[model samples]
Target: MRGKNVLITGGARGIGFGIAKAVAQMGGNIVCLDSLPEPVEEFKELPQRFGVKTHYFRTDVTKESSLYKSFKDAVDTVGDLHGCLTAAGVALDKPFQEHTWEESRRILEVNCIGTFFSVQLAAKQMEKQGTGGSIVTIASIAAQGNTCPGQRLSIYNMSKGAVKAFVGPLAVELAPQKIRVNSISPGITRTPMTAALAIQYPNLVKMFDRVPPLGRMGSPEDIANAAVFLLSDASPYVTGADWLVDGGLHAGTSRSLKDPSEQ
Candidate 1:
């Protein structure tokens, strides 16, 4: 990935930050767009630490104009992009009945609509450059539907499901341009987003932990590792695919090895 320019949304923290770190370490120039305020010191020091250029812009994903301007600025600052990670998204964990229409709209706007436009904007840049590139969308294990009974996130699940489905057709369309589109469906990962809630309700976190067959929760690095692979040249022949980075959580949560004597 050396000399490559990669753009990441929601890159100020959590899974996005993890991905940014991995890309920078791999010698890729990074441009991060997020709704949060700039972390000036943190982003400015990235280049010195990883020996790669890093830039961060505050942009709201729900607003197309803001996102578009940010995209343009990123290109102007970093040159043509080699890869894009659409990690900007929102989550709603309330029960179906408790969710209001506004919540539904907000989640979809950030998680689905935001990704849709981000991919389009990034693809256009890649096409204009006449260079094949990679696009990775961040989906979630909840997209698989009812994966964990302990929590409720109907809107979030629906939004992510839509994102996961969006990749296949988009990949097919972009193939002619030598551009690849893919998605990563991550399970419950430890991040700032979930930390406060976890501390407030440790029992809920413990319940979710039991759902992963791996006997542990995931980390941002776990997802970032997979994102790097999909973005690298190693996956040139792979596209329109969904990589489930869930620690086998999608394989029914309640399972045990069969007794050899019974066999």
Candidate 2:
């Protein structure tokens, strides 16, 4: 990925930040976009530590205007993009009956609509450059369905399902342009967002452990490593595929069949 300009939405923190660091290590210049306040210290040290150029733009992925302008500015600052990671998203879980219209709308706007525009605009820029690029969106295992028994996330699940569905069509549509489109479906990962959940509901920690057969929750670095692979030259032929980064959760939890004494 050396000399490749990669744009990462929600790159200010968490998995997105992890992806940024990994890309820098691979010698790729980075354009980190997030609605959150700039991580001035981290961004400053990135170039010096990784020996690559880095730029950050505050962007709200929900708005097409904001997204397009940010993409344009990012391209102008760093040159044409070779890859884009659409990691900006939100997760709000509530029972179907209790969910207010406002809450459901926010989740759909951020997780589905925001992702849609982010990928669309990035592909447009990549198309204009006449150079094929890779685009990765952060879907979730929730798209499959809500796993935790007590958790109510009808709307959140629906939002992610939309993202999972969007990737296939977008990938096929952009195939002629050589712009690969893909998504990552992560399980219960230890992120800032989940940290709050853990604090609010201590029992969720235990619930999360039981879901992934690996006997542990995932980390930002875990998913970041996967994203880097898709963005790198190593996966030129890959597109339209949803990569499950949830450690064995999607495959079903492991279990002991019987005791040795029984045999």
Candidate 3:
């Protein structure tokens, strides 16, 4: 990854920031596009900390105009983009019947539409550069199946499910250009977003504690590790694949009906 410039949406915090740090650690220059008014302190310190170039632009992925301008600015600042991760997304936890049309629209706009355009802009840049690049989108285990039983995420699930489905065809389309597109579906990761969710609904914490076969919630680094792999040259042949980093949560229940001795 050394000398490569990777673009990361939502790079101001959480899983995005973790991936940015991982990229920097691998000696890659980073260009961050987030809706934050300004870059955070840690993000600001990346250049000196990692001895690599770093740039941040305030970008709202839902609006193609905003995304286009920010993307142009990012390319002007960082040079050719070799990798991208579309991680800007939102979540809602209301029951399907109770969900308002407005609430549904917001989640779809931010998660689905946002991811769509971000990938488009990144691919455009990579295509123009004529340099094969890797693109990774953030999906969720919720899209695969209901990981959180009681917590309703109908709209959120639909949005991410759209993302998971979108990757395969895009991968095939981009293959001719040597651009790889894939997604990472994370389980219950400990991010500020999930922390707030857990606080609002205490049961979520218990679910996080018990559900994963790994016996713990995931960390930003856990997901970041996978993103780094997909972004780096190590995964040249890997594309159009949705990597599930859910600690075996999606594999099925860890519990058995009877003990081995009883059997």
Candidate 4:
């Protein structure tokens, strides 16, 4: 990926930041876009820190106008995009009965619609370039299983599920152009986001402690490495594939006596 220009959405920090910086350290030029203020300011240091060209764009991925402008800006800054990693998403953790209609739409609009815009806008730009590229969407293990009690996870799960569902058709559609479409479904990773949650609820930690086969939570680097793989030619033969890096969370937990769920 040396000298290859790539756009990373929600990339100012966390998993997005890790991937962007990792790629940069590998000699790839980065265009990191996120709506958050602090990350944009903080990420400015990446280029000098890693000795790669890195640009920052503040963008609301859910808004079409903002997305178009942000894409153009990223392309203008980095020369043109050879790849994109869409990591922007929102989480709604309220109980199902507690969620309001508007609340669900807002979350889905940000998570699912933002993902759509992220991929759709990138594809249009990639087509105009008439060159193939790679697009990686960041999903979660929650897409695969029921976790977190009292969580109004319907829309979050739905949005993530849609992201996984989208890869196949997109890959088939873009293969003629040599553009790759893939996804990374990560388990819980210790990021600033999850760190806050973990502090708030200790039982959740114990649940992950005993449930997951790996006996530990994931890290941002784990997910970032997978993102790098999906973005790099190392995965040249890969497309429309979903890679799960969740510390064995999806596999049923080991329980011999009474089923854990029943217990």
Candidate 5:
């Protein structure tokens, strides 16, 4: 990732920030776009801390107009856009029956629609530069997990499925132009957005012990590393693929362990 100019949506915090920092450490410039002003203000120090150029632009991922402005701002400043990490998104955890019309719409508008618009804008910018680029998204294990009957996350799960469908064809459509599109599906990760929510468990560590063979939740760095690979030349032949960084959670999604007596 050295000498690369990268832009990440929803990069103010969480996995986006982690990705930003990771790339910065590797001698890559970073431009982050988000709806919140605080993230931009706080991210101002990343340049000094990571010894790489870093900038933050405020953009609402849900709105094309706002996203356009934000992306344009990044282009003007960064000079060359090599890739995009469209990780900006919103999560709605609600019962399907309790999901108000507004809530459902808002989730899709940001999580799915937001990703689509960002990818289009980034692809166009990269095409104009003709430098060939990588576009990665922060997807979820939910897309594949819904086959089981554990969690009731219908909207989030469905949207991720949509993200895969949305990114694959574009990967083909943009292949001729040299732009690679990919997604990373992460399981539970330790980020601010998930901190409080995951804390609901009395014994968080103990509870997580029941998770995959890894026996714990993931970290933003785990997903960030995958983002870097998808964005870097290392994965030049990898496009339209949803890379799973779920600590083997997907590999052992269901349990078939029988009682000790039966064994």
Candidate 6:
């Protein structure tokens, strides 16, 4: 990743920030596009910590105009984009019947529409550069199964589902241009978003322990490790694929069988 410039949406915090740190550690320049008015304090320390160029732009992914302008500015500052990660998303937890039309719309706009345009802008720039690049979107295990367990997240699931569905076709289309498109479907990662969910549904904390075969919730670093591979040259042949970093949650049931003696 040396001399490469990777752009990350939602890079101000959480998994996105983790990816930025990981890329920086690999000697890649970092460009962060987030809705936050200013980059987080930790973002300011990237240069000193990793000796890499870091830039942050306040951009809302839902608006194509905002995304276009911010992306252009990022390119002007960082030179050319070699990799991108569409991590800006929103999650909603409400019973399907109780979900308002407005609530559903917001989730779709932020998670689905936001990702669509972010990837589009990145691909366009990479296409123009003619240098080819890698694009990774952050989907969720919820797209593959009911990850929330007892809680309801019908709309949120749908949004991420759209992300996972599009990567394959997009990869095929972009392959001719030497661009790779893929997604990472994470399961029950510990982020500020899930921390809030844990408060709303306290049982989620317990389920995190019992669910994944790894016997623990995933960290931002766990997901970042996968993003790093997809973004780097190591995955040249990998594209249009969805990597599940769910600690075997998608492989099979994690529940242990009861012993016959106990029964």
TM of each candidate vs. truth: 0.94, 0.93, 0.95, 0.91, 0.90, 0.95
User: How many backbone clashes does every candidate have?
Assistant: 0, 0, 0, 0, 1, 0
* Shift in Å, residue 80, candidate 5: 1.3
Candidate 4 segments whose C-alpha is farther than 4 A from its true place: 40-42, 148-152, 254-263
> Which pairs clash (backbone N, Cα, C closer than 3 Å) in model 6?
none
Of models 1 and 6, which has the larger lDDT? 6
Compared with the true structure, all predictions reach lDDT values of 0.88, 0.85, 0.90, 0.80, 0.80, 0.89
**Residue 91 in model 3: lDDT:** 93
State the number of backbone clashes in model 6.
0
Candidate 1 segments exceeding 4 Å error: 40-42, 254-263
Over 71-175, each residue of candidate 5 has an lDDT whose tens digit, in order, gives 888889889899899888777655679888788888899889999888888989999998889999888888774422234567878888888777788889999
TM-score, ranked from best to worst:
6, 3, 1, 2, 4, 5
RMSD of each: 3.2, 3.0, 2.6, 2.7, 2.9, 1.9
- What RMSD value applies to candidate 4? 2.7
Pairs with steric clashes in candidate 1: none
- Candidate 4, residues 1-263, lDDT tens digits: the string is 88788898888888888888778877788887788865735467777887788877889987889888988877776666789999988777666778788888887887788888888878887888987899999878877756633335777888888888888899999998889999998887777777666676667755655565676768878898888888888889999988988878777553521365657
Q: Where does model 2 exceed 4 Å of error?
A: 254-263
Name the lDDT of candidate 2.
0.85
Candidate 5, pairs of clashing residues: 34-59
Question: In what order do the candidates fall by lDDT, top score first?
Answer: 3, 6, 1, 2, 4, 5
Q: Is candidate 1 or candidate 4 better by lDDT?
A: 1
Model 5, residue 86: C-alpha shift (Å)? 0.7
